[model samples]
Target: VTIIANLELKKQQLVLPKNALREAFRISHAIAEVTNVSSSARQPYVGVSAFAHKAGLHASAIKIDPSLYQHEDPASVGNDMRMLVSDMAGRASIELKSQELGVDLGGDKELIGRIVDRVKEMESRGFTFEAADASFELLVHEEVNGKRPSFFTIEHWLTTVERAEDQSILTKAEVTVTALGKKIICTGIGNGPVNAFDNALRTGLKQLYPELEVLELTDYKVRILEGRLGTGAITRVLVETTDGKGEWNTVGVHENVIAASAMALEDALTFGLLRQGRKPE
Candidate 1:
């Protein structure tokens, strides 16, 4: 009887009823739909990954029926599924990608295999497809068409930099380019790598293409890979340029920041030309 006099207090539990839970879900879905509608009206930049996929099984299933792997129809997202072929892929996948590239794969198995192996090896060395470069695409085209750039070659380049307390850092870059059966040397000074290199390159190429002024740099970005403690680690550089007609992105990677930047700039120029239907020499 004395034990019954003592009692323990328990905390009250709060829970949503089934009906209330269902109503909450409906309200959240409605809010998301409204938000998406408003965002679509703003016309924001949508990336390829918005609809791109990489899973092998998913790719196979999508080839059969896109609905099997995708949450929304690619058309709804204004995108499509892309199947990439590499050494990791099967022959079926290779065939599909080859067909997409408009290559006759019926008798080109060896070539296709070689391309796949090359792609795999390059990708392992930090190459990527997230931002597909038309210049690299052109290289693939050339490899398939047996045509490649040979009109011009860089014999050598020399860059000199000087720092002053007051004025901007003076950068003088000189380049020797061989083109049209002749070797030409050009020099220019600018505030940075891009400007200096561009000034020099334009001076050299202007004689070949008088329309050099039409080309303009649109965007530039440098990314550090495995970067820690602000050290200049492996860096990937991207440059976007346009000739008032079309725009393209080109990429380069290197341990040397200046060298990587220079390579990216060159890639941008080369890609810009290719986009205009001009074959790089």
Candidate 2:
């Protein structure tokens, strides 16, 4: 569960993630028993569809009463019912999620309607929200209030690779970002391009978010959502981050792995600062 939860908590059953580890150990043990064996795609309680609702007749009944389709209350197992909004899901699902996430859909039904349409279009392109709630939350935030002020904006980043005198490879990176409308630049070196990029980005803003000093990247993952798209296939990046307290997951998707990784990394750092309510120039 540590490995999975570090990346995405929802995948780890019974754990109250991103909030507290109150039941993390017990829940991980229970999850081990369920996941140890070869089980069906639809497991008893933690499977993807264990508490998921489609946008069809079943969803219709769920809207009226959840008990209609759900054999048992998910809350009893420490999991709440959720919906996977796809092309088929009705507006009710999004509205319900808005209530759940506390997004202020308010009186603007048409605005949410547009967001729903946008989600469907993205799903059609193989961009899924099932494992990327951070990205989804950002999307909701953007749709509701437009782009809110971010911690900083990247002016540019550059990387160079060359052979050292001893015939070993050397990668160097330089990054500049604008925080509080002031430009800051820093340079770094790493084993490879991505590593160098990560280093430079962090060094550039260490003064702004000193928490970055304690931050750690526990794990990273990349997936090609659609092979048929070839070079245009969307890449989803999952990054696990921690400040030695607890771990949280952030995700990004793009046509380029580097770009996707950058997005996830940025989100992870941004989330870290937000969690601590820290802001610096």
Candidate 3:
């Protein structure tokens, strides 16, 4: 049999018998098995799901034997196989997901029919659940609970702007928030609407959580839709922020660019506070 041995850097060469070729193949396979298991443990967040297929003929082949298409069984790489149903899906696929969710296929025909119809309708509207998995989870919870959230509420807001020469602008934003038998009003000033809004949000939240810090705005982007005269069009704003530990993104859309940026800014701050385990004031 082929023998395998670990040697120090100074003793790198190993003299072996010519008949040990078969043993070498076995040793190589054994080493490969161990390396595969070790590397899989270090796989990052995306992992195998980063490139799994779940549509068209590929899904069918995988369902038969994952080895047929997938480089490895999804489970081997710490990923569970998934199939996304859309307009292109057949009834079999729908039934599979329903059964997996523990829905009674025989008696729940009407509900299943409605779900498939709704999925098709929502997909047409650019509503995708693949990227925003948390949103999708919340949607499922709301559907099952039929319960409204009873959390903090925004009472009112006022924003004032002052224009200066050389394209410089100043903005002051004020917000009234009500939560947990308390009402707080805060105001802040900044170079732009989003900055002013974030400052106001932070001021309000800091009253409750004084240890909150290290949060900073990293980037902001705005896209104008329906370019009518290239001015007064629907604007979509994307905000990116980090809290020293991790970063997140949030988006808002509106006809007013400033309003869109303000909404996005509020979302970013709220998300950051949530991540820090503090409730918004």
Every candidate's lDDT: 0.60, 0.70, 0.55
Please give the lDDT score at residue 184 for candidate 3.
85
RMSD from true fold, candidate 3: 11.0
- Candidate 3 is scored at a TM of 0.54
Question: Stretches of candidate 3 above 4 Å error?
Answer: 1-151, 164-168, 211-214, 278-281
Worst 10 residues of 2 by lDDT: 1-10
Residue-level lDDT tens digits of model 3 in 1-281: 11222121124444454333324333443565578742231232223243344454665565467678654344322345555555554444444544443433553555446555655665454344332222222233334445322234567777889877876778999978775667889898988666777788678867765544677887677776667748877787777687877655655667777767765565665556556676433
Best by TM-score: 2
**Stretches of model 2 off by over 4 angstroms after superposition:** 1-26, 29-43, 46-50, 53-61, 85-89, 165-167, 225-234, 243-249, 278-281
Residue-level lDDT tens digits of model 1 in 178-220: 8777889999888776578778987897798666668888777
Candidates sorted by TM-score, best first: 2, 1, 3
RMSD of each: 13.3, 7.5, 11.0
* Ranking 1 against 3 by TM-score, winner: 1
Q: In order, how many clashes per candidate?
A: 1, 0, 1
lDDT of 2 by residue, 19-61 (tens): 4443433364466658885334265554535677767456657
Q: Which parts of model 1 are misplaced by more than 4 Å?
A: 1-48, 71-107, 165-167, 228-232
* Residue pairs with clashing backbones, model 1: 151-281
Backbone clash pairs for candidate 2 read none
